[model samples]
Target: MANAQLKEEIIAYSKRIGIDKIGFAAADPFVSFKNRLLEQQQLGFESGFEKGSIEERTNPSTLLPEAKTIISIALAYPSKLKNAPKSKKGDRRGIFCRASWGEDYHHILRRKLQALEEFILTKVEDAKCLSMVDTGELSDRAVAERAGIGWSGKNCAIITPEFGSYVYLGEMITTISIPPDTPIEDQCGTCNKCVEACPTGALVQGGQLDSNKCIAFLTQTKDMLGERYRKKIGNRLYGCDTCQVVCPENKGKDFHHHPEMEPDPDIVKPQLIPLLTISNKEFKRKFGRISGSWRGKKPIQRNAIIALAHYKEKEALPTLFHLLESDPRPVIRGTAAWAIGEFTEKSCEEKLIQAKNREKDPNVLYEIDKALKNKEFDKIQG
Candidate 1:
């Protein structure tokens, strides 16, 4: 098959398989990506992942040595939650930001990409194909931009004119050569809404994204919160979407209701009390496949306590009380003490003092005292 014919066939099949958009890009390595990665490494922005991961990311040859073209695909996440559930009492505001409102995108994207890969091999018997959802050395966003599917916004997300930034990107690295599409011009012109709206200043001036301050990255970190970054966490329990939400391009993209991807009403905006009370077995059963599962139950539990503390709802006092004395994780216990201190009145102060005496962990005691000090409970008791 000719390159043009192959491109047309793949695009047709992609749309048939539920991808909203598909485009082709020449498998040229990203030229400036290496330098950016090096800069991030030196600045201590690279997380637990090794610095070598970045080099592998910039080298298309490492991903697919024989690749001549990249096939980029995007699926639009439902922008509106037509059946939006009520936020629990004392719940913090904010939706799941579409991309994460439903079943895991990785599972959905991979199954579809693998199907596309199978379809391609039937057309070109000897062709080699590799599929990746966000889990490859090659950058899906860069490939999508190069393929003219979208332009990279200052927030480092590829934004389609039709779907805005509410699309999930996937890619196929293949030996099959295809006619590459022309790149799109940057359409984000002079707009700084995404940058200015960032709660943690993660998106520093212009298009530079410092992952160190990124809420999305922080959400995926392990049990311990970094000292400097914890104060900026706000009430976010999972990924952050302030940039995408504030983008003018994403305006009016609300109320998407795809049945296949719809979030479980119970799971969407879950009650903090339930999270604090859930056992590890239940946690595995509930969140095993979601991106939030990467760090296991402990971090999610810890984050729930932090969010509860920030909410400062007196209603959450009972939940915090139960967690303070019995939670297995010391981090969760400490934060629960802090939450109790923040919300419970002097009426609850005696109970807190009793809990503080029984609390074996030093961190929990420290936070208890800190919370009491902040509330002037020490002066009252004195």
Candidate 2:
């Protein structure tokens, strides 16, 4: 099959197989993309990519030695969450951003790409192909832009007309050449809503997102966080959607509803007390597929403590006290102490003093002292 005929058939196959948009580009060296990837590494903003991304992206031959074309595809997962709230209620946990609410896109999109690859191989007889969703060294946003699916928004997410920025992207690297699609123009001119809406200021300027300050990243980190960032995390137990929710482009748009994306009854609006008390066995059983469960129960448990402190949920006092004495992580203990201070009253002051006496960790001691002081201040006020 000639290259021109192959390219046309590939696009047709993509649309027929549930892909919303498809674009083709020669697998040239990603010079510009490499520079940005390196810059992210230098700035320490990259999560898991910095360690080896430079070598893989700088040499196109690394991802696929004989790669001649890159086909980028987009699939929209519209937010059709029934009974989705207008505003967060007390001690509530919101669902993952629309993109991740369903069965993992990696599984769904990979199957589609594999079928596409098989179709192409049957036609060309000797075509070689490789498919990547979010797990590859190739720059997905950069490829999608070049393939003309959508342009990067100020929030650093690809924005599509059909689904706004709530879409998943996947790519196929092939040895066959295809007609390149014209790249899309940047339409986010002077729009600052995404930046303005971010609760943590993750969006700096001109599509640069500092993942360090990103709520989504902070909530999911396996390491312990200080009381400072914990307070800002609010009630979000997993990934955040502040920027996407506030984008003007997403206004008046309806999300594609999927049954799998529906919020679990307990997770949708979790009670802090119940969350703080969940056993590890229960944690994995309930949240294994949810975004926050990937780090196990520690982060989510810690976030529950933080939310209890933020909301001053007095009902959670016994649970927080148990954690203060028995929780394994010092960070969790400290947040538990903070919650004790914020939620407990004169009735709990003696326990706080007792906790301070037995606590070994300095951070936990500091939190106990803070809680004691606040308890004293509350008595004076009353």
Task: List the RMSD of every prediction in angstroms.
Answer: 2.6, 2.7
Query: Residue-pair clashes per candidate, as listed?
Result: 3, 1
Any runs in candidate 2 off by more than 4 Å, and if so which?
A: 48-51, 84-94, 257-269, 375-382
TM-score for each predicted model, relative to the true structure: 0.90, 0.89
lDDT of 1 at 63: 70
Quantify how close model 1 is to the true structure by its C-alpha RMSD in Å.
Answer: 2.6
How would you encode candidate 2's per-residue C-alpha lDDT over 205-307 as one tens digit per residue? 7688888888888887765665568778777777788888888888866655444444554555455667777888887777666544677878778877777
Model 1 C-alpha lDDT per residue in residues 52-136, reported as the tens digit of each score = 3775677766777788888888888866655556655666432233566677888888988999999999999998888887867
Lowest-sum lDDT 10-residue window in model 1: 89-98
